[model samples]
Target: MTTALVTGASRGIGRAIAVALSERGDRVAVHYGHDREAAEETRSLLTGDGHLVVGGDLADPAGARAVVDTALEAFGGIDVLVNNAALAPSPATLHKIDETSYEHWDQVWSQMLDLDLRAPANVSFLVARALISAGRPGAIVNVGSRGAFRGEPDFPAYGAAKAGLHAMGQSLAVALAPHGIAVTSVAPGFVGTDRQEQTLAGARGEAIRAQSPFGRVATPEEVAAAVVYLTSPQSQWASGAVLDLNGASHLRT
Candidate 1:
């Protein structure tokens, strides 16, 4: 069976990815940042004998090692790695951003850099290296955001970080190609996760929907299906690409 390691598997799109992989008979390592209860719920929903949960704060460099090591020990090896965990919506303007305090511009930007850009790149490299050392081929799917291409005026730092992630994915794909590893980025528009639903209940949500061609947002399952496809052997020839799962919502200029 194929072994897939999925980060941020506690909820939202991450949980859906884990379930889809498991349903397809792939062994899954559900990685969680904090929510153990939610992680356990995801693990319980998964089928098959080798499905397991591994939790750690991936924002820390060492935590990244712990996550990979545990999965390796349990699954024997990994064939796919999904970098999906992320923090969101810092809610600040460019000029208003202060570069001083812990929650200010610099710190917030650093946190976003660490989690969104650095963590994914680090994980991809380590996993790719492991597979290369063993003379095996693998897949790396980095969860990206439409904000990386479209400007998020309210969340500039996050947009910047995701933009960096998009660039990183492309570079890694080329760098790891000779090593027999495939790397790609999946950029999605607004999804109907719990947090996203709550935000939609707030002001400006209706207005945003009205602008989209679909007149609605995407569901977690829809995005999860894309992940499963890209990570599967069926998509082996499709790498170093940015697959837009955004339903043409960002097409309107």
Candidate 2:
């Protein structure tokens, strides 16, 4: 049986990914930042047994290590890793230039870069090392953002971090290919997760939906479905590839 660890699985896209992985018979480790109750709820929504709920503030390097270590010890070894945790853009996270103070700008940039980029790097390192030691071929998928390709004027740090994440995945893919490990990323434009309900219902709802020709935003399950394929055993050839999940909203040449 395959064992997978999914970070930020307490809710939103992370929860959906966990559910999808569980339904496909892989033992899942659901990692949350500081939401044990929500993680347990995700654990409940899972399809099968052997699912685990882990909590850690992954922004901290030590916390990232602890989460991966616990999962590795409990599962003996992990075959898949989804670095889905992130500091998404919101009212509180927004730091636009000219309007925001220098101190606030520095704070947002530092926090976003640390949690969104460095933490994933740390977790990937730990899990990849574990898989190598175990002599196991595995997959690591990162949930990046379309903002990396487009632009996040209000959240420049987020865009930079995600772009770094995509590059990091490609680099890891090449480095781990000889060991039979694959690394990939999915860049979704605007996902209508539960947390975005308020924004989706507010003034930006129509404009957000209109970004796609389908007149709708991507769903968490849709993203999860893409992950299911990328993380599957047959997709080893797709290593180093970054798949776009936007609904014809943003096209990259």
Candidate 3:
């Protein structure tokens, strides 16, 4: 069975991806930043046994390495890695130009890039090296954001970081291809997650849904399903691809 490591698996899209991988009979290492309880809930929701819970701050290089080491210790080896952990846009993280102070902007930009871009790159490095040393084929799926293409005026850092993440995945895909490792990324638009429920129920909800012809936002499960396929062995040929899960809300040429 495949041993998968899913970062930020405590909730939302990360939880859904963990569940999907577990349902497919892969032993999952659910990594969380702080919420151990929520991570345990994700572990309990899995379909099979042998699931593990690991917690660490991905922004810190040492913590990121420790997370990978913990997963490796428990699972013996990691066959799949999902870089889903990120500092998403929120009221506290919003830094719109002209409205926010330069200091605030710098702080938010640093934080977003650290967790969203650097963290994933570091984790991928550790996992890819392990797979290579063991001489085993593996796959990596990065959870990127559509904001990288459509832009986020209020959270420019988030958009830039995601763009970097997608580019990093392509670079790694090419670098690791000779070792039988495939790396791909999924850029998802607005997803209906617990964190977004309030916004979806507010007055702007209709306008948000109207962005896509389908008249609704994508669901976390749908994104998770795409991740599942991208990380599967059969999808090796799809390496370096950046799949869009935006429901046609945003298209890139």
Residue 222, candidate 1: alpha-carbon lDDT: 93
Give all candidates' CA lDDT scores: 0.85, 0.95, 0.97
Candidate scoring better on TM-score of 1 and 3 = 3
lDDT of 1: 0.85
Candidate 1: regions farther than 4 A off: 90-103
How close is every model to the real structure, measured as TM-score? 0.93, 0.99, 0.99
lDDT string, candidate 2, 33-143, tens digits: 988999999999999898899999999989999999999989999999999999999888899996999999999999999989999999999999999998999999999
lDDT of 3 by residue, 93-195 (tens): 9999989999999999999999999999999999999999999999999999999999999899999999999999999999999999999999999999999
lDDT (Cα, tens digit) per residue for candidate 1, span 1-253: 8999999999999999999999999999999998999999999989887788899988888999889989988988889999999877644433234333545666667777888888887777778888988888889999999988888666677898888888988898888889778888899988888768767888968876765688878889999899998987778778888888788877624
- In candidate 2, clashing pairs total 0
Measured with C-alpha atoms, the lDDT of residue 20 in candidate 1 is: 94
**RMSD after Cα superposition, model 3:** 0.5
TM-score of model 3 vs. true structure: 0.99
For model 2, what is the alpha-carbon lDDT of residue 243?
98
